[model samples]
Target: MALVACLAVALPAHAVNQDDLLPAEKAFAAQVSRSGDKLQLTLDVAPGYYLYRDRIAISTTPADLAGKPVLPAAQEKADPYFGKQFIYHGKQSIVIPLAAGAPADFQLNVRLQGCAEAGVCYPPYTHKLKVSAAGGKTESKLDNWLGGAATAGKSPAGNSELAAKGWLTTLGTFLLAGLGMAFTACMYPLLPIVSSLIAGQGATLTRGRGFLLSLLYVQGLALTYTAVGVVAGLTGSLLTVWLQQPAVVLTASALMVVFALSMFDLFTIQLPNALQSRLAESSNQLSGGKALTVFLMGAMSALIVGPCVAPPLALALGYIGSTGDALLGGAALYAMALGLGLPLILIGTFGGHVLPRAGNWMKVVKSGFGVVMLGLAIWMATPFLPASLVMLLWAALLIGAAVFLGAFDTLSTASKPGARLGKALGLLLFLLGGAQLVGLLSGADNPRYPLKLIAASSAEGAASHPFQPISSIAELDAKLAEAKSAGKPLLLDFYADWCVACKEMESEVFPQPLVAAKMGQFVLLRADVTANSDAHQALLKRFGLFGPPGIILFGADGKEAQRVVGFTPAAAFASQLGQVAH
Candidate 1:
């Protein structure tokens, strides 16, 4: 009876262990198919397993049989073994470019690694595939499998269909993004520019002339945006970053201040008398000269006045970089610019009829614009100032504006509705300004909210896992080694004072309790690239990154697990952390 009980327990334990083990081939199945000059590698991963995107390597037996593969963007994951990484689950397909005059048959080698959901990791597995290519003149089996031929002189019907769909999607996304950006603070200054242009045309301006001038102005803006976007996309350098430098910001702010003073009638900005005479003579005959000037102003507005980076611009640039399709990218940018200029067009065409003409009301409107310009100037200079100083400046501006609006003035019962409204707005501003001043006095950095709302413990927790500063690649490598030795993950953040997205991340994402807790499990490091030193440039180049607002996570094994290129929301970021830390 004792022997029977022992055998019963032993047999069940052995069976359970056997069922837990899965064959490598069953876990990850890879296949190769050729279509014209392109080779498609497909992997069907089992439900419980996922393959690493960066860990997958391909090589031909003849070595020169094929060029490097063009990989699609993979889904981002935070891996337990690797910090942050790109991975593929279920069905994954990768396209490889074949060389000309390649053999009809070649031995293709695929090496890959993956992990099971149950915390089981497999060693790197190698699969040898016998790949047969179809003739250059004929479509291969992959033609049906891949559903397209990417080679030259082939049926581009599939390619065209795909391109058309992609273009429409990109165009729609950019259009919406452009419309949203039109109302942003960076675009406010351009409103006065458009209003001034239209209002300056005098009472003799006709609707037909107004429409023509507006169209011309918008065309100039769109063309400049398209051209700059194409160049920036091709070069993979965003001009917004360079324009955000402290020196550049200060110069731009000073120029805006001067413009604001001019708006307040402190002084007039005029061309030399001889130049004005020549311009007047040119405009008298060929209206094209005036249009040309308007066009130049539009171009300058795009390049200098409102150089804010939006999601649509980043999306278009990313697509251009990946596909090297400048034509499509340029068209997308043009569409977006037209959308952004749509309001300007409307204002230029109809503003003359709507705005009060050559009266005290006009002066009041101009003064309001001057106040707006001053606000923009302060906004531009905020990055260079301490957070506390920025908050105080904002408070001062609001309080001063309230005083100008007669917030403290007593209103009679017989006062006009407009006067009452003005006093009411002024009071609201005064209250908000008072709140901000109190927050600043209480050591709050954020100008948007008061400090007393946050508990002391939460405030302490917010600063607990602050990022360790790193400046050089050597320092990064050393940190990675330390993290590996300690069996912990590493999170490297690329930051810059001028990077708007970076500031957003710091303010909105990193301070979240979930993000902070997840960060505590990793060796937190930050590389401030605001200086753009050679070391900073090298660090960016090493990761193939163009600018800041990039986050890279490395696993306990010292391998990069995930990479996030731009600003990610807190919820999505927390999801990423869940994958690796949990």
Candidate 2:
């Protein structure tokens, strides 16, 4: 009997009776899981069945994915077809690296080639997995090949626009990235408190002390928001879309305008006199810890005057690679968190001192910040306003700035070098502001190219990349199936009017002649999530996307090939299309 069994197993791989052979899915069972920076794949082989280790290959959709599988030791076996090869018997688990800047979500294309020790060798087979940091979904090709099931499985979803290489590098990069955002927001509500922290009540704090405190404050700001935002994304919190509502946008912008008004010394906001007296009495009741009391006041003031100062990156940090670690996600938001803190430092230290002391010049500085806040408020409202109206606003702001800079001042004292410099800048701005007014009258709506008719390229119409718009999940599903059947690459864009980055892609990227030509290869579908209705919410949920400005690329086979989150420049977007969908 032993001899007979040995003979049965020793037969050539291709010599088995077809009727006795088990199906491939039964012969090799697979299970997938993820940990930290690695994806763990487990496969159970049936008795008398074996898999070729060298033939086992795993790759992600983007094709240039980092990391490789760390396969365990395999048995050396002589094969009639391929000579001696390393193979696995019984069951084996393999690990694939996934966390080298992997997107919060992606897909993995696995190639599992194996055969039975019985009479036949099965050819190499392909399997596709939809993966996110949270976990992966299995849609085995073996099932479709054997059973002819439809490939209509749901795709997976999270995350930040993309993850960082590692924890340390991510944190460091975010911290430095804060510098750029600070200038972009130009929000300086924290300046007063931060400067006060450094300058103290009556004395200047040491530079080292100021920095440490500022960092602490930023840590406090980043930790809560990023952790909450990531969890919120994973939980499908309404915060993402809810925050984008017109009422909310208007409210946030209004609050900012109030802060700006205060900075400009236009008006002072105070509690009713009756309530103010009671608050003073309560404050007087608590005598000790004057320092603590002062700190409390500063904290309250920061929250009230700058509620919007929290890092916008928090929303972008949504569902970071299913890290399940809020602190890790917070590290990414640290960039924007630091951005919020940076202005405080710069405004305080600009006068050559480590921090700003209360001085007459503070009026000028406050007014400057007020101007920035107004500009930001206007930017927020741009999507809701007409292009012509937006241009008029910009023109007005510029002309107002020119006037404020003493462009038309007649005082002879304007001969001072500083005054002369201001006048020069003011004159330049006045001219540019005049140009904006001219362009607005000339029927040019693009603020960047205010004088487009002068060029007469008529590029605007050519650049408008038309898209077939889908509103709900049902519509999207139908469109996707149609695209798949048409044998073309599919490009799905998540867009909303409120999304500044989405508009950037619309104006700057999609219109590029080369980009447009490349886009012709795709069946373009845009999900206008502008309404944020129940169906719209469901559509976003289907793809695990948090907000607008996301692009999903699918191959002709109907499997997702790549995901592009946030703004992608035309050159890079064109290059990405070069490979097309793989």
Score every model by TM-score. Answer: 0.38, 0.40
Q: What is the Cα-based TM-score of model 2?
A: 0.40
Compose the digit string of candidate 1's lDDT tens values, residues 209-254.
7777777777877888788667755653233334335797678677
Tell me, by lDDT, which candidate is best.
1
Q: List the residue pairs that clash in candidate 1.
A: 82-555, 83-554, 83-555, 84-561, 84-562, 85-561, 85-562
Model 2, range 232-302, lDDT digits (tens) per residue? 43443244334345787567667667766765567665456686566445534433223444444433433
lDDT score for candidate 1 against the true structure: 0.63
Clashing pairs in 2: 14-119, 15-119, 16-119, 174-335
| Candidate 1: segments with Cα more than 4 A from true spot | 1-238, 286-361, 452-582
**Candidate No. with top TM-score:** 2
By summed lDDT, the worst window of 10 consecutive residues in model 1 runs over: 7-16
Give each model's clash number.
7, 4
Q: Quick one: RMSD of model 1?
A: 17.8
Give the CA lDDT, 0 to 100, for residue 574 in model 1: 73
